[model samples]
Target: MNEQETGERDPGSGERVHWSEDGAERSALWRSESGARPPGKLAVADDRMTADAAYKLACEGTALLWRGDYHGARQLLAALARRVDRKPPKEGATPEESFHLYRQARFRRARVLGMLLVPLQISHEGTHSAYSVPLRRAPEVAQACEEAYGPPGEELTLVSLRELQGVLGAHEWRRKGVPVEALGGDRVHPRHGVFSPVRGEYVGLVARAPLPPGEPGSLVAFDIGTGTGVLAAVLARRGVGRVVATDLGERAPACARENVRGLGVQDVVEVVSADLFPGTADLFPRTEAGADAARADLIVCNPPWLPAKATSVLEQAVYDPGSRMLRGFLDGLAGRLTPHGEGWLILSDLAEHLGLRSREELLGWIDGAGLCVAGRLDARPEHPRATDSSAPLHAARAAETTSLWRLAATG
Candidate 1:
């Protein structure tokens, strides 16, 4: 499942921020997707402020409210990033320690960069509301802001320029869409918060894996935690008759529904708002004679690979604390499968390399769940980060492999 998805409510939507300017006190809506609170201290900054001064203030926990040119604020953010990058954390004693240090550094960097803020204003027309930065040289961002935060409200908002840049980038991706080669070059348009399927090796594994013994039209498959519904759509295209794609939150399900519809797999893929599977009884109820509903002929799950707490909405797609989703899928897999059904667990070995998880533990979980591996397919990491030697955990990533474990219920 992917991580980036929009929420029902924008982050910091109802929060208010206060600051003083020219002997007047002012307040505005404080918006943050990371759920950042209003800065405890605020300072108005403009073209006159030096990048070094702004960086110093940001590091000291004072938010710089930009009253300068919009593009200059971006440049200033970039300069801040350059400064932050100057001091890289020392490598730790082990891969696990290195990973933690890397995460901590990243958290600090985002916080420092996020201290640069901008004011957003909404102007109303006869039947339309538009969002823009009330500063010189501001680009038109109404569409991007609308797509991310919903229709513009009357409240003026203060948003981190870093977050706004993310919004703008997501808007572009949604406009062009990410191409999925396994889907015969079709594109999957990811929403603001919904995780995108930029990694294709996993999807290709699904496309080429041997199907369970049944005609495509006769097989009923369940895609657990379907993020963009990309895998569900892929299953449909591969001939699965009924593909139930389920996700927990509001944004993912909605994003999946839209993508599947666009892919013309709406007939075969059913996007559902659910955790793991829809209510178990509804999906696997007893028949008239007390026989179980025909359990899913094929169950596919691509859960978040890392076992760690998510710091933000986007991280949820990458980190799964305690391997909760992974274990849950394994624990529930056997009960929901047909006698001859197959469950595909798509996962990466990066955790193993990082010493966060061990291979034996994963196998033990499967055995405990009454599942036995029937077959396995493996793919080398093709993502850029895997080979980027400069990456903090490059050793682990370079050695990572994604695998699809074909699991069957143990007798």
Candidate 2:
């Protein structure tokens, strides 16, 4: 979805399309004020357009409306993907350089491929006139489209094939959940916009790390930047007396709340909306005592591992601009610890390996914040990227180890 995704159009990026609104042909440069809208040059295509021509137009950032067969569009998309994968980036001097370049190339590839468009029929009375597109063998995607984009605003609207694919994928994931071994093999179904904790290494570290010494009934933990509430649920299952999880995104807090409710840990876990921590100067207010007492026996944060700007809302889970969340968590760690209590910082060495951040700078931030590394647990990455020989970043991936640094306040 990247920058092409729906929302306010960048000042000069939008152009009008001529289509019939009533009996007369009218011109409307349609732009979604909000929502995931695909950005590109658009043209209406019937069954006459060939796959080769469609591929060329898509590569040039042109979206084609399918007045064509439904199944044919799917095949054309596959052909376009094949072309994209065939052209790999040239090798770089180091894996780090190669990894960065590979990412850039992949991103552009995705942005272009996403230009393939799908049409939805929006009836005047606010219901779909036909759930199926003009294409043959297309499933009843009306419900899925409505669920993803909300009710259509006009007689017709365009959605990128990639976006619809995401909707369908989310539906499948919601139907059959992802298994989190940390939650005693319980399934955690992630809603879109919420990062799924399928990465076992980090969650494994959270599950296996020693619990701080305290009466079992009095232990409280905070799940900072909680996405799907997987960590919060894991904490609650491990018998933490209370777990408070916070997220600022419109979707994440609700997603986390649902996960907590579904896991039956709603009684022990409270999902709240906050930018980073529960209390911040501009957003939320608390008394000095309130802030002091809110410090928990444990605070856990797994921020975006990469230090890059996220162009879209969804990418926020993978890229943290200027290491904002990571630095914030460290800067506030000492203030939010209960004297003897610990802050569990779950991080990966990927950024350092990628030459994005340094070990000395990270240590300096910790010391500058008056926090010290107490004990650390490390786990090797088990994801496919670690062993994919064909992947450009395989070298960096092989050496990656995610760690949970037990941080304590320095006297």
Candidate 3:
């Protein structure tokens, strides 16, 4: 895939960022995983730059190319964060309004903090990709950068320090992996730009949900939008013999496949790159007599909960724009299920609490899709943010309940 399709910015692409230093114009390949446009104004900063001055420049939309010690840069970033947090967005009258305002505030904060930039010097040597931060006291980030951005071409890349820190954190998470209780304590390693299965409530619900009537080794299951393949692996471990896990775009499929293989379920789970159902042809092909093969006995999906626009690649895991994935899953569910099959839609009521979507609308969609709710399994979120009053939309989050809706086709 090309850079645009894969969400990977080409360092050698036309998105070059230029700045002035020592009476010469210096330019480097600009990279942003969030797809943010390069800053229109540029300034060179070093150890002598104060946090206040830097914050002012950033607020005025000037990107700072750091030429200071790495630790000091981190300190300045933290200082800027403190300043940003000192002033909070004004709460709106309604829950939905408040949620939108909160998102706006976050966007502004990210934009300002993202202004702190760093230069990454890189080279490609046959099979080895060498990279480093060209600043004093900079940590060894070659492996992290390589893992997140892929092997670099022979170009100096300019990236935001905020994004680089995220890359480093994602690398660590990918290396150590997150422990999923539903997977018998096995871990799921998420790559950069892929959503991590840190929220275990949904996984637990899937692990405990009742499977369709069949022998453990005889059932076929489909996991839609399998982010890190955690749910797919859970189903495989639960003895659903044949599991087809489908995901869209580049990172998710690759990440899910890696996790599935690492968890030793590659033999049972097939990871495919498709929007949702994989058009059904991949799982069932035409036979000699042109007979239709049996559909999946179980189909599970955990789409993004919020019906709002996502500003970055990471937010796609949290925001669902217009509930497109949810509605699409429901609309196509019945046609892809066996007569006695169950479609488990794992979702949260946070949107309802935030007034972004109504519970009535959800049920209506289910009915309109020629399906009915057979049963439902509910779990309260155990994530710390659920109880953190300081978090955005705390009231909505505190009352959130994640449910696994067991659905079946209506005759």
Taking all chains together, each candidate's TM-score versus the true structure is 0.94, 0.86, 0.94
lDDT of 2: 0.74
Give the clashing pairs for model 2.
6-37, 69-135, 70-135, 70-136
Model 1 stretches with alpha carbons more than 4 Å out: 1-13, 280-294
When 1 and 2 are scored with lDDT, the better candidate is: 1
lDDT of 1 by residue, 1-411 (tens): 011111133465576777678776677888989887777788889988899998998898888889988888989999999998888668446989988888888898999999998999998888888999899988889998988888888989999999999999988988999999999999999888888999999999999999999798988899999998899999999999888889987878888998999999999898888778655445544312454433688999999999998877878889999999999999989988888899999999999998999999999999999999999999998899898988778899999999999999997
Q: What is the lDDT of candidate 1?
A: 0.88
The lowest-lDDT stretch of 10 consecutive residues in candidate 2 is 1-10
Off by over 4 Å in 3: 1-12, 89-92, 123-127, 280-282, 285-294
Identify the superior model by TM-score, candidate 1 or candidate 2. Answer: 1
Question: Compared to the true structure, candidate 1 yields what TM-score?
Answer: 0.94
Clashing residue pairs found in predicted model 1: 3-195, 4-193, 4-194, 4-195, 5-193, 5-194
What are the clash counts of all predictions, listed in order?
Answer: 6, 4, 0
RMSD of each: 5.1, 4.7, 4.4
